[model samples]
Target: MGLIDSHAHLTFPELHGQLEAILERSDEAGVNQIITIGVNLSDARTAIDLAERYPQTIRAAVGFHPHEADSVTPADLHAMAELWNDPTIVALGEMGLDYHYDFGDRSKQRSIFARQLAEAAGRPQPLVIHCREALDDVIPLLLEHGFEGRRVVFHCFTGSPQEAAKIAQHGWRISFTGIVTFPKSTELQAIAREYPSDQLMIETDAPYLSPVPVRNRRPNEPAHVHHIARFLADLRGLPYDDLVEETAKNTRDFFGL
Candidate 1:
């Protein structure tokens, strides 16, 4: 079975300028599908456009990332909500808390996240969360908004086992990126090793974290997701093909692909 880079930002400048080459490489690497995520309203529109252009291989997820929280407006949210009408818009986020950079006001990030959650309250689309050093607040906010038992995923998870367990307890998912392959990410590898297979998925989060052997390469692309799959297969003691099938299935199930 082919692998799926469940999370990526294909519309980002780093990758957008050379999408044809990227898709060619991804094909050669066995990454048959990619879900391009949007960090803001404009980016989300671009993501939808990319998905529309490459219907078979790309899908889009829309939301205001925590880093852009400070710049969001009520009208922006309304326009984003209108995007759901697009058949290509598969999910509603990359949204959540990020205390690490504090690029956006923490209060605004939380408020915007809450507002988006409220907007998504009963929608059928699953959530694609972008939590960084803010799981405590993230989990509570998700629950506060009645997300328990809902379809949600914490993308590029770098949390501790306890945090992973807490997310699992809520029937949510945790997706891994190339970061898990870093030598210093031993604890993260451990979390991946034991995380529920059904709730597990993989991504490149591309134009960003490139897996080892290619980690030195800047502006990582979906093609590098193959390296991540191989690394995780070894880390979890499973055959490479098996890990690919499992993660691909999980990604498809989660994103309704």
Candidate 2:
């Protein structure tokens, strides 16, 4: 089976303009499917458009990012809530806390997160969470709302093993980005090596954290997921093809693709 990029931002300008070539390279590299994430209303619509245009290979997730939470108006939330019913939208996020940047007020971020979590609960859809240095806050909010039944995933996970275990305890999955391949990511690699295989998945988070061997080479793309999968295979001491099939299956099962 080919690799599935569980998370990416193909609608972003870095990769959007040359989608044809990007997708071609992705397909050639054995990356079959990609979920393009939308951090706000505009990108959400754009993501849907991209999915529709590339129906064979792309799916979409829509929600306001925590960084953009402060500017989110009631109308924007309403619009996103309405989008929950759109058949093409597969998940509800790219949302959560971001205390690392403190881009938005912590309180505002929490409020926005809770609001979106309620919408996700209402629709009973999976969530693509983005937590950075705020798991302590994010975890409680998710639990307080009783997300036990939700299929939530921590995207671009770069957390301690304890944090990973915490997420897994809640029956949530964690997706690793190219960052896990960095030489300095020994701790992350150890986590990946020991994390339950069924709860593990890989992504490129393209147009962002490019994997090593091509670090800072240029804007990342879905095609680079191969590097991540290979790195994980070596880390976990599994056959390369086996890792590919396993992660692809995890991606499909999680997103219900």
Candidate 3:
């Protein structure tokens, strides 16, 4: 079975400029499916366009990232809501709190996050979360908005074991990126080794976090997702093919891919 890069930013300038080569390389690396994420309104449109251009292999997830929360006007939220009408849009968000950088005002971030969560309340689409040093706020906010279980996934997770456990307890999923393969990520690696297989998923988070061997490389692409899958398999002590099939199945099931 082909592998899937559950989360990526194919519309980002670093990867968007070489789309053809990227897809070719991804195919060669057994990464046949990808969900390109949008962190803003403009890229969200581009993401849907890319998905439409490559309907058989790519899909889109749209939202306003925490950093962009500072400038989000009511019109922007309205426009984002309208994007869900597109058949290619599979999920809502890369949205959430980001206390680490504080790129957006904390108050605004929470407000936008809550608003998006409210929008997502009864929608069939799942949510792709972008949380960093703010799980305390993130988890509660998600709950307040009535989201739980398999409907949410913390993408590029780099939280403490306790945080991960909390997410698991809520029945939400967690996705790992190249960061887990780093030599210094002992805690994350340990968590990955024991995380529930059914809820575990892998991604390249392309245009960022290139895994181990290629850790030094810039502009990570979807093709590098295979490295993440292989590393996770080895860390979890499962056969590589088995890991690929399992994660691919989980991604398809979670995103309704």
Candidate 4:
């Protein structure tokens, strides 16, 4: 069964530095497509390059991470806007709120999010979102912008069923990561089971939130996506192979792959 690692940082130092081996392992595990996220200005270039060099296997998302919220400049957004046309750059995010660590000022984070959204206006691509303790603001922003019909994926979803319902109602997609495989992820499991398969996706979010049975490690790899897929299958009462196929198709459709 083929699967897509919908969100990952294969452009990052650790993984990108050894992409030959990484791609080999990912292929071995049946991970055919991956979305490389651009966390900041420079990251946009690397992700784009990676995608261009591996068009069939890799794609990229252009946005500034909330941690770099305070440093986001107009020039940075402009740079991302320029790369929007590179067929390899498929989405506009991995951007949103992150108040847990407050790596950057909260207000600055909000402004950056809005600015990126405005910059991406009229563009035909899904938004890769990353929200943490900011749904109240995040959800409303999407509504205010009338971000309907545009695919928006809540990457690494940590929200509840109610939140999932709201996002789903808006026609936005939700992508689950390795976190769902954790033992205390009952809430996530429940939501995954309830959400329609079309609105669902799978990602590794590698070098960050590695899935269970392997959470202790850092710099997670795309191959771990299989574990997340298995968990989702159990959650939805579907066979593992069937779930993989559906998620793969969903990922391609969500990102217009």
Candidate 5:
């Protein structure tokens, strides 16, 4: 039952502390590949370095997350644009607006997101978006400039079934993280029901949002993505092996893995 964690923050401090052990456990859990998402300029170098050093174990996606909107500048965006040339960097994200945190100026978040999206336009690279209580603004941004060679996936999706359907209609995929396994996440489970099997994917969002069985831990890792796949497989009444294969293929095709 080979699998892939489409979104895992291996560069995060908590998980990065024990990356080798985590990788060993991920392999044991059958999670064959992991994508390390760079949420800000600070982590970009680490993400790229990891991907370059361990091409078979990791891939990268770099962008300015909404939380860091205030910290980023036009100069930061320019630097990120140059990173597009790195073969190990597959996506421009996890980037998008997030009203939930309100950690940065909302306007700043929107501006950064739009800039990043525009930079990603026409490129073959897929996007790893992180929309949070801001899909009303997020969806249209993605629609404004259509994706090209690769696809876009809403990582650790926390949207409603309606929002999921809306993105699905636009040819984007929605990924579930350990959060989907939360006992209280009935809505996430319901949203899961709305997407067609082929349009859904799973992730760990490691070092955060660890699924139910593993939620007690502060940080998560790729190995725990298996818990999400299992939970969804049972929730959807699909065979585990079939679900794993489909999601793995979905990850590869979306990221051009």
Candidate 6:
């Protein structure tokens, strides 16, 4: 079975126009499906359009990232609701807190996040969250706003094992990226090994975080996911194909692909 790049930015400018070639390379590298993420209204629409264009190979996750919290207008949320109803829109995020940069006001970010969580209250669609240096705030907010029974995956996970255990304990999933292959990311790799295999998944988070052996590479792409799969396979002591198949099944089941 081919692997899935569960979180990527194929709609981003750096990789957008070269999709055909990039997709070809991805296929050559054994990538089966990709989920492109959107962080704003324009991005969300563009992601939907891309999914429509490449329906067989791509899916969309639309939401306002915390970085853009202050700029989000009521009209934007209304537009997001329209897109969220589309059959092609698979998830509601790339949304959460980002205290690292704190690009937007923290209070606004929390409010916007809670509003979206309300919108997602009983929906079947999962959430693709981007949490950076704010798990303490992020975790509580997720509980306070009613995220108990929903599907949530923390994309591009760089958290410690304790944090991962808590997330897994809360019945949420965690997705790893190229970062796990880094020589210095021993803690993350440990989490990958210890986390429940059924609850674990992998991604490229394209246009970013290219793995080792190509750690210095620029504008990372979905084609590099195999490196990550292989890394995890070695770390977790499973065959490469087994790791791929397990993670692929996890992604498809999680997103209902």
How much RMSD separates candidate 4 from the native structure?
1.4
After superposing candidate 3, which stretches have Cα over 4 Å from the reference?
Answer: none
TM-score of 5: 0.95
User: Residues 13-58, candidate 3, lDDT per residue (tens digit)?
Assistant: 8875799999999999998899999999999999999999999999
Residue 191 CA displacement from its true place in model 6, Å: 0.6
* Model 2's TM-score against the true structure: 0.98
- Residue pairs with colliding backbones in model 6 are none
Please provide, for model 5 over 1-257, each residue's C-alpha lDDT reduced to its tens digit, 9 standing for 90 to 100.
48998888899878656988998999999988999998877698899999998889899989888999998979999998888778899888889989998898999998999998888896778888888899888888887766522388888888778888787777787888887888888998888865677667888887888787878877777898888888888988999898899888877777888
Indicate whether candidate 3 or candidate 4 has the larger TM-score: 3
Q: Name the top lDDT candidate.
A: 3
Better of 4 and 6 by lDDT: 6
Q: What is the lDDT of residue 52 in candidate 1?
A: 92
Residue 53's lDDT in candidate 4: 90
Error of 5 at 193 (Å): 3.1
Lowest summed lDDT over 10 consecutive residues: which window, candidate 6?
141-150
**Which sections of candidate 6 miss by over 4 Å?**
none
In order, candidate lDDTs are 0.91, 0.90, 0.92, 0.85, 0.84, 0.89
Q: Relative to the unseen true structure, what is the C-alpha lDDT of residue 62 in candidate 1, on a scale of 0 to 100?
A: 90
How many clashes (backbone atoms < 3 Å, residues ≥3 apart in a chain or on different chains) does model 4 have?
2
Per-candidate RMSD, Å: 0.8, 1.0, 0.8, 1.4, 1.6, 1.0
* Candidate 4 TM-score, true structure as reference: 0.95
Candidate 2 or 1, higher TM-score:
1
11-77: candidate 6 lDDT, tens digit per residue: 8888867988999999999998999998899998899998999999999999999999999988888
**RMSD in Å for model 6:** 1.0
Model 3 scores a TM of 0.98
List model 4 lDDT by residue over 3-79, tens digit each: 89998898777775688888898899889998889899788888888888998899888888889899878897787
lDDT of 2 by residue, 118-197 (tens): 77776767899999999999999899878974799999999998998899889888899999999999999898888788
